[model samples]
Target chain A: MLDFLSEFPSLGRRDLSALRQWIDEGFRTFSRAYGEQLEAFFNPLLRFLVWFQDLLTDAPWPLVILAIAALTWFGARSWKITGGTIVAFLLIGIFDMWEDTMATLAMISVATVLCIAIGIPLGILMARWDRAQSVITPILDVMQTIPSFVYLIPVVMLLGIGKVPGLLAVCIYAIPPIVRLTNLGIRLVDREVMEAAEAFGASYRQKLWGVQIPLALPNIFAGVNQTIMMALSMVVIASMIGVQGLGVPVLRAISNQYLALGLMNGLAIVALAIIFDRVSQTYGKRLQAYRETGRD
Target chain B: MTEEEPKVRIKSLYKIFGDTPKVALSHVQAGMSKSELLEQKGHVLGLRDINLDIPGRKIQVIMGLSGSGKSTLIRHLNRLIEPTSGEIWVDGEDVLAMNDKALRDLRRFRMSMVFQKFGLLPHRTVQENVEYGLGIQDVDQGEAAERAKKWIDRVGLAGFEGHYPGQLSGGMQQRVGLARALATDAEILLMDEAFSALDPLIRTDMQTILLELQEELHKTIIFITHDLDEALRIGDRIAILRDGEIIQASDPQDILMNPADAYITDFIKDVNRAKVVRMRSIMGPAAPAQGAPVAVSDTIEEALQKLHAAPDGCCPVMAGDEIRGTVGIDAAIQALKAPAAAGAHYS
Candidate 1:
């Protein structure tokens, strides 16, 4: 593949060596920086996360299982989803990956929260300003296309290794969809609504928070939903940094040729994605419904 | 004319669109017409030296064709689009000089607008949409809700409190739009062809609603429309605008009877004089005491109704129960038969 790529008329040897050198330099820099600064504080962040993970264990397996079942029941507005939710978790328990699954869930929850925090405001800004949109759109395009493995280097330099850095990497990889979708949602709000707000003596701020943001919620939620799925996909790549969970099992399995372990971990990921996806999509639809009916 | 001064005043208002507006407009003022201004430079003078004085509580309608600057004129009242060179005073306050706070305060407290496309907040319920203006001023939730409910009820949207705009028909949405503006209690209402977007039947319904509201409140209104029928129906004082100038402004009766210019005459030509024109104005001599006579105040619709019920299409249009002139069977028949037949001889 490398030889085929190099055969391109524009290709050159110096470019390849320079790329190799850059990759080598980035890895060493990250290794040194992360070990020195993150070795202590990173441990506590992980412990705090793991402590939060332990708090979930306090709910008891049956209650936790029932909550998931309840979610799917109310969420899809269908009993079929409720049955599927129960079965998916059953598969995780059968595979003996419940604890690791919970850890992955905690990391995902945190990253998803961060994505919403960052993405919605960016989307709002982009919607309101043409110059801001012109500046942000190309960058978002690059962020979405850049591979998950490629992001770990800079994230490790900026925040360094372990839970925080891994989480940051996941955020970078996942947040673009939310921002783009949010911008799309807000831009799609009818021109009349904005004009109405203005004519009603609404300040710009009032129009934004009161009209634009609420109207754009469904699109933002879809973006958030996609972001969660992206974050989950990045979880395995993030684990290659000193982060751990179901991703660790998958990484270990991949390295040691443990097919059963890899297969089981991958199945756990699929289950988790389904569970989160159905729930998020259900809420997104609910918001659209509420917007239509003007109900709470 | 009133003992109290006019509520709104504009003097020599000109809105020129260009980077070098002053330069472009200066050339035009030096004896060049608007077309010449556009030709000499890439400058289009949207509004040119318009002067108007709107009396308090008057429903003054500005009628014009599309691209004739009626929309632009209405927008200027609220500073939605600032005039290029002009002064507008609202309630003795210099509108052009107001800071952002003052302008916004004026909008929230004293003025509001109804756009043609309802412009309802799609994400809000009809009730919440009405509450939006109050919310902008940070009114308490209870007060806003109460006011919104009152206005919504007034506009006859009481049961539709929770319905979004998409669920409502074009006319219903316009009712919500009118309610939203009225809820603000702004003394001046600027309507930019407020009912123009609806079907003819629905448009009539909205115009009826507007008439009822005006009867009750009598807020100073600035209405813009291209439809002359609508313009005549609602305007207490009609201002015929042509290419940014008010060609004729007078009581509707006066304008219908005697238009100010040849352009205005041409515009009013199709407006059946028999319908809007009084028999007293069109008829010259009183009828001898033998033939039937139509009433002086009889609208052409009523005259036609009478004619339709009579043995022949003719109805002697009477003034004050006295025969002014015999509108012979031939005349009524001609009016009924062809569009061109009526009003030409009268004019």
Candidate 2:
């Protein structure tokens, strides 16, 4: 009895190893059977990412700079932000990081678009039904709290270290904020306001598009901003699995102990993040301009 | 007073609020009190055995304090809150039997509501907000805008059409709310404490505007309020509710002259009777009198003012072109001085 209490009863090491092996074999078999089909399903996304990256890299530097400045101006309507963005791009170009920066930008943009497209609907579903919220919330928790490398192993096993798998990993990392915020934003809409829409005979689609979506825009934009930041932060980890970006050189610097190379690429990433954050936040604030001006 | 058909009829309506409403409803139907049901079954009784027939082209006021279910009762007309069991007939059609599409159509085209909180879309400008009801019905955009502009002008909000609701005062927001509800051209206007959020001065101004609009439009209006003064001011008929049950429902003068019970008497105890008691209630049978004639519709205060200025202390109460009765100073004084607890003596 004393020996048993001291050791504690547990599964034997051989049994645990066998159980792990069994799970590993099951996943490998599953991936072997469905890998080609899954790859085919993601072909369009792969093609789109390649085309976007090529477009950014092949376009004249001046033209790209001008387009980004115009977009910044349109979104933020601030001369300071537009000027700062132009200067940042010029600096990145001077540092000979233009090609990698464009690649990273393309990846971040596509990741953001995909996350919004999927996350918003899921968030809306969660807001509308308690059961959907109950089920999805825990899944989101697992996706968020689980270490990036843990999911990377299975993702790489299935897709075998390419852009599509890397993109999937970034999306999984960045999607939770958008979904959670969208649900919260929609739920936070005034109850009386929703009732008024209902009393006016607004159908479900009408209420969603006209009232709920418009009112929730600021929150959705916040989610989008967070998603972009998270996706940018994942660039280096994503590059570990054969994705190309500034992250590639950063990874090289890390492995070779080259401090200057890592710092340059890291600063480029930080600049991009600031530009995205400011522009999106400014646009979100403008959407709620009415709220700021009212007396009571 | 005419024998015309009622525009909206509610029969034996009951509303129990809880997870298991049907079970709670059984207890309420069997004469369980509201508090008892709430304590024992954890269910709220929202409304109980409500029966009312609202006449067309008049303001029907549902009056009660907070939590008395006056708001809940008005929502039943538009089916905003579904009854636990009852039937609501609007224009002789069964409202409760409508499918989703039919219900939407009914709300979109036949009934429009103004909210107490002035539920204007914060994202929309006043013009767009007013045009919302029209837009929902898939009306042509230009025509909807035109109609919306007309109402914006009518509600005295023409110059402020571009301003957002947040920029407006409470009174102005409600004007936008009124404009939005009226823009649909629906026949029934359901105002759920529409002016209760405004200051007293703004509330009276809104009341006057509503009355002025009702005079020209002659739409069937259901107005809900807690203030007895507001009910007496605008209601063609008033129903006083207490604890989810209607204690009394009648013409304002009838309620003033003969309260149904102690609860109603308490509700009207502080009301200034001189303002609400009309000459028609205190007038004697058709008889000749010496002073200048006062309209039967005039309040006792107005009649007294005229009677005091006349050489004689009596006045003839005129109903249209004919004198229906006479009112003396002594009777007017008695009417004004009568205690609410002893209101039955007047009847």
Candidate 3:
């Protein structure tokens, strides 16, 4: 077809040989320009994430448990959270799995905090603009639905294995719940209430800060709580990326077919999960109740 | 519109909410009334071009059934909803022409609103809700607190300042809302059925509070309500609206005694017009003064009670302690007898 077109009067001198040559050269340059590096770009990051994981597994279990106990005591300021924290403290201390438990808690904390810090602002931006919401919502969905292992592959490729990379992957895996919830919360402010603020001479910023955002606090807190739980869930998966803590020991015990080690580390992870869940849930409940009481 | 000038001069204001408000407005300016422009653009004509002159320091009720544009009209005064076209000369300045900041300043400083649902901030306590606007105005905490305390007490919520709105009854919530609007101390008050959310008894209680507040402060008020009884009971001048147009804007007695059309007549028909219409409607013109004078505010029931106790079978309608007219004893009795005979349910 190319040779026939070249012979036609209207066709401007099409040449198959030259075209083939151009295609070959273009393919060569394209491969040269865009081919993957032999060295995994994520190796350093993956290594760092694994170090983070190791820190979790290698840290003194007693110290890790004590830190969590202190955190809940300060934040919740209630007997229930304090009691739960103590139970978490004793469970690790008594089971003689204190080191692994501490490691798990550390990993989960970093993952959850990072998730929240990024998630909340993104949610606020989505709430503030429909275009941003449309663009970001699909990305959040992708983050939420894709298998956890997919995250590790890319992290390992770009940054190498580490505690940081796993934590980063864990955050990416868990943050959507918070962002989606935050956006929904802000959007759900009563239309009449918004109108009242405007009628009362409140500026756009005033309405957002004074009325809409404040009303949305309970919902946003719920999102944050959900994020915490999700981040906790991702801790185990993240351990695959060289994350330390209970996951590392469990994985080690599993690979070596040491049933007792696996069971003990798993139990320690469960304890950490319960502590994280209770504290986050209690704080979120406190926020909701305070709002109701204040409004009432 | 007078040279002496009223506080708010709303002339041919229009608010059509749909598709390209700017484009709709430009089309309206090309020689079309609000409804015509709305029809031309196939938009919901929320507010027809309404020209109203609200006087300073008077309680003017904008009465209408649902979807009658009473709320829409009042909302325009504060620019909570901007008018598509037409001029709102607020104290001789075109309100629609004010820039964003100036308009907000106007709304915050000069016009404040109370909603039917008691639009208190749900995250705030009664005290905070009352202080919300004051805070927005940059009033110092102490002063805002002081002002909030004063109005909260004035609205008879003296002990409930610390309580949240959800803890308060519907009436108390409305009171908090009123106190919030009052705390702002804005001269123009736009009340969109502020008392309607309360039960009947609580509504009456809030009504009395509002009457007292108006009497004391004499703030110019634009009150919107679908309840005709509320309008007749509270309004200094009532504008009867139907289908986004004012049918009549007159004194309550004028609206009750001589309603504008069949619709308004039906609206006032079931109302015990005799009870709502004062003795002035039944009384003879100024008679020779002989005894103590009854103020125009005295109700027929009150008049009946006062006349029954009096030896004389007559009561004089008094203004500033002078007899303006005489409501005869026979006339009073007949006025009393007629409603009772009509199964009017005057009570």
Candidate 4:
């Protein structure tokens, strides 16, 4: 059996260098053709991110803290949660991580919005058509299973090293959860309910907007939460391509082997994650409770 | 079919489930068994050559056990389940020939349905759920709200309008389902086991509500149920289905007095005869001599109660105050006796 295995040989030994060269050449040509237009398309989004960052950092610290407290109160709907959110923000201030945190926040916000804008419709398409599901499912699997660092190579090749490339790479890494959740949510809607809608003669558009989306909101929000978390996780990795944030300090600490700086930045990231996580998860739970009241 | 044309007419309806249904239909028509068709051809015979005429403004009850295609047959009337091959006529218009838009129009304006599980939109309030049909029909916002509110009140769910379906009890949710259907003001109302999810007491209350509303509205209702008693109580004409075929179609009194075959006989064996059997069914030819009078529509139990009050132990059966025939105490008592169970249970 061992002799026969050697006789069959390994798949790696059969690779053609010419085939690899041709594929790389083809990709380069395609990238050359589409790169400028893609960058132009992303210009508005990039501008929005810059504007958001300025807004967050330029505001008076007291007003920004008050606004954060208000948003926290709205999202978690508890005084304890609002107090926790304020403490988390105050810790960033004490650590002197405020400006870097704002940059990370802006980058994550842009990446999340982009993911939702792209992921939801694609997810709906997957739910609507078997063919679309079949086509996109494998791609999503690859995106999720591959190492996040591996995406940087492709992003560098296409758009080069910058905040835009870093943002795109983070979005690519973060989008799968929202897409998968959206598709699952729509598919999970009760079949009898869908039939009832059809029997009542609802148009396809009406059925989608009126029934499906509203029912799927809780799941979709869960997806958004997961996307935001994933985007935040990509922070330090994204900083490798010159995206500035708390990740920059983390990257600097890593290169210099500075323990205090690395630990402080890492803890700041965890703090941000906890605040975002609590608010979003609480809101999602509230929506689910609102939808299913008799259960309790 | 008597004085007025039927509100719905179905002819030669055949529904087979599979991609190659036409091929499977041929095998089914050629007398292949349902299991044999499934095993050999991978297709299920959902409905077989069903013919029925549902009279206008009368409650036409379709009763059968689960998988008997009773639900399947009713769904065909609304084109919710497209038949493999069939003709459906609603109000003398060919339903099968209608395009998608026309079919939508038919569902929106001419027919409404109540679902078994109370298919209320969980995200919507009860008022919004009740208003769904009217909204779909493009009724004006204010007018639709008014009509929905009225039906909601009629269904005895006046204060629950602000509540969600998930917040309401099953019976209340079903009332919202009823209100939704009624608010459309559609001529035909199709209720597919609309009360099956409720508790027994609530189910009876819903039945009373439906019957009382039917008295006033007179909408052509096609009610599907597995309960024989419910069928007898509400149905003007009852059609029994088994294995995707109509076993019998007749008046409820006829079904109770003379079941078509062993299958239908078995279905009605456990039924309370005094409650189901009517005076008209037990009455003999009209006699010149009569004492008290009972309505022809009166049940055997009522007729017996009436006969007990009569000194001679006999009462004339009246059809709207006109004497048609007389039912004796002996005949009413005889009809009240339950028939012996004589058939093996079908698998």
Off by over 4 Å in 1: A1-48, A57-59, A70-77, A290-296, B1-3, B31-40, B279-347
Q: Tens digit of lDDT per residue, candidate 4, span B8-92?
A: 9999999999989999999998999888999999998999999999999899999999999989999999899999998999999
lDDT at A138, model 2 = 100
Worst 10 residues of 2 chain A by lDDT: A287-296
Lowest lDDT 10-mer window, candidate 3 chain A?
A: A34-43
lDDT string for model 3 (A1-296, tens) is 89878876543346766786697687556545543452355356445445665675666666655666677877676877777777867866787766666566666766667677888788889989999999999999899999888767656655456666677787888899989988998899988788888877887789888987788887888787788778777766777887766777777887899999888777766666677677776676666553555334
Alpha-carbon RMSD to native, per candidate = 5.8, 2.0, 7.0, 2.4
User: Which regions in candidate 2 have their CA more than 4 angstroms from the true location?
Assistant: A3-8, B309-312, B340-347
Query: Candidate 4: misplaced stretches above 4 Å?
Result: A1-4, A7-16, A29-34, B306-312, B338-347
Ranking by lDDT: 2, 4, 1, 3
**Model 1, native contacts kept:** 0.43
Give candidate 3 regions above 4 Å deviation: A1-67, A94-96, A290-296, B1-3, B20-42, B282-284, B287-294, B304-316, B326-347
> Please, what are the lDDT tens digits per residue for candidate 2 over residues A28-126?
999999998999999999999999999999999999999999999999999999999999999999999999999999999999999999999999999
Ranking by TM-score: 2, 4, 1, 3
Tens-place lDDT per residue, model 4, A133-252, is: 999999999998899888787788888788899999899889999999999899998888888889899999889988898888888998999999999999999999989899999999
- CAPRI level of candidate 2: medium
lDDT of 1 by residue, B1-347 (tens): 33888899988999888889998878767867778777878888788888998888989999999878889988888888888898999999899999988888988888988988888777678888888888887889999999999999998888999888878888898999898889888999989899999999999999999999999999999999999989888888888888777878897767776667667767776776556654444444544433445786666555655656556545566657656665544454444322222244322
Please give, for residues A33-127, the per-residue lDDT of candidate 1 as tens digits.
66656556566766677687776656687888897788777777767778888888878877799888887888988788879999989988999
**CAPRI-style grade of the A/B interface in model 4:** medium
Error of 1 at A25 (Å): 8.3
Per-prediction tally of clashes: 4, 0, 34, 0
